[model samples]
Target chain A: MCDSCGCNITPGNRHLVAEGEPGHQAIDVLQHLLSANDHAAAHNREHFDRHGVLAYNLMSSPGAGKTALLEATLQALAGEFRIAVIEGDLETENDAERIRRHGVPAIQISTGSACHLDAHMVHHALHDLDLDAIDLLFIENVGNLVCPASFDLGQHRNLTLLSVPEGDDKPAKYPVMFRAADAVVFTKTDLLPVFDDFSIERATRYLRELASAAPVLNASVRSAQGLAAWLDWLRDDMRALRARIAGGEAVRPAVQPDGAALHAAESAA
Target chain B: MHELSVCQALVEQVVRVAREHGAGSVARVTIGVGALSGTEPALLRQAYPIACAGTPAEGSTLEINERPIRVRCALCGAETDARANRLLCGACGDWHTQLLSGDELLLEQVELAKLAEAI
Candidate 1:
């Protein structure tokens, strides 16, 4: 039977079957599925630079304490850095509410069924938040280590978290996320003594293998251990972003009386 | 889980490719699913149809080529296919094995057909 017309067709005209019709020609296409997401992410990066906001995309598995780390970060850096958050979740605005309680502006982007937050969604959330007023922007990506690694959220840096309870083999199991991350945070260190699953040496070795130069920070948000170091790293990042802005290395928004800067000024007033 | 999200990306890529080549519809998309890529082929298959809905590649078939995880043992000069759940080299009981393949998630090729011309 012919693939095209379901008739008993010979092999000589099988090209037609492959083509589907007489005029129909088959074209070979080789492309990456993440191309669109990558393009959008680049645009988002430009948007962040224009507003002088240094964005960080945070990724981790559920119960990796990403929210807790953010909470502690918000508390520690509130006075020093003008921070804002865009929280992504499968459901609920709970994470956003938590961040908002810290007095920092936050917007919840509920993906509903989506596993990861792509660049387009982040772009929309940026409009709602006063980007100019924000020195640092943290995008708490949906708590899935696997899918989020494939999609770039247009952030300047990507941070992946792994908790002690999740075991030390995560870096080896989920290499893509570890390889893509600018930094890896080992969260829930306070529980390390209780759990035989986590191994610092093994995890560190695996992380180094996947991401050679990526910094790994071990922290326990519950105990406030290593929180200062995390904040210090953030401060350094913000300082570098500010320097880039001041040196005209970054794209600055056009000075209109009605743009983001004006909006931020008005809000401050 | 996350495989569903990846399937969505795959569908979008197929549709975009079909449109670019003036293809009426996509027939098949050949993707390379690596063993250590952490994507489940079954879950991806389940998600493909839902993701392709309302897209140009709606009825296209997803052909996944599962790439075996190949690793080189550090202790011994032997390369072997590593198991998905276990990283140990079959040739030698060595934990220090460098991965050679099976981490890629690529849409290697897309087959599309143009519409028939009106007689």
Candidate 2:
């Protein structure tokens, strides 16, 4: 106890020796550290909804065929629905350039050293495109399986790709990323015949271990085996989103529950 | 790896709070770090000082409360604590589980310094 005003002394605030005597005030902030990003994400989501755009956040390790899959998806859907892409990388417009070649609007977010694309970056890119002109929007996050999964980015669905060469154990090793996925895709599946080490069954088992019931689809831009399923899935989501919007409601993806509370859509609603 | 940026945001919030309360300096800040939050606590701890440099919270202490993962079973409607990697419900071994409260990067409280009391 202090000789003067008896301020409660505890191990946590012991270092505040000067203030331990009295006049110490503790404020309950009760705020999420990711609140800013989440608010931006919610705003971005609203933009997508207002324009009736279906957004997807695509994440994976480097060279995991995100751009390649986007190229293939664009080729498949460009004729039916107007598409746009926001490509994220440490530093490069290469992915955006590739998407633009498909005659679709593509905005590039160069994060410099950031490992993931946050909502603010996506919001900035969102302004560059005519949201009404877009039917489907893909945000290709920086090639990272770890951090990208943690951010919302206002996507209606989160897709994490695990290529065949990357091995089936990826779902086991990165449980958080796989767990956050609305759907996990096995990219570069054409090489499965060559690589004996990769097994779709084992990968599915590992994903199930995380208690994730996310659909795991196979895809190969080169061979186009699962290409139809991918397109069909997009169409299904578009139809679902339309239904939700018609009922005066919006759709939210399965956000990692803890961080979900911080998003503006829920908080303000 | 994003811990540094996380810490930076944390410090910014703390400093903002201190300024808002007209505090001369900040004494301590507490945060909850969850297992599934995708942020490494050790890395966050190491990055705190760097983030707080030259701010009102310069010499403040950061208390990290490591939270455990908990999941709610869709089948059984039970909420149970589980490991980070394995999120199955403890009540029943069901594959359908909804995470209740594991991934939390939350700023809980901030202690601000005031005038010393007269002894």
| lDDT for each residue of candidate 2 in A1-269, tens digit (9 for 90 to 100) | 66456367554654455334367788888788877777788788888988889898899999999999999989988689989999999997999999999998999999999999988989988879999888889999999878887777888888889999998889878888888888889999999889989999999988987888888889989999999998798788779878887797756776554555655435766
For residue A114, model 1's alpha carbon misses the true position, in angstroms, by: 2.0
Q: What is the TM-score of candidate 2?
A: 0.91
**What DockQ do the predictions score, one after another?**
0.24, 0.58
lDDT of 2 at A130: 95
Judged by DockQ cut-offs, is candidate 2 incorrect, acceptable, medium or high? medium
Clashing pairs in 1: none
List lDDT for all candidates, in order: 0.74, 0.84
Give the DockQ (C-alpha) for candidate 1. 0.24
The estimated TM-scores of all candidates read: 0.75, 0.91
Please report the candidate that would top lDDT against the real structure.
Answer: 2
Report the C-alpha lDDT of model 1 over A1-269, residue by residue, as the tens digit: 44456576543443344555455456554444555665566678777887777888899998799999999998887688789999999899889999989998999999988888987899888889887798788999999877776666677778889999999989888776776677789999999889977888889877655523577888999898888888787777668667876786632211111112222343357
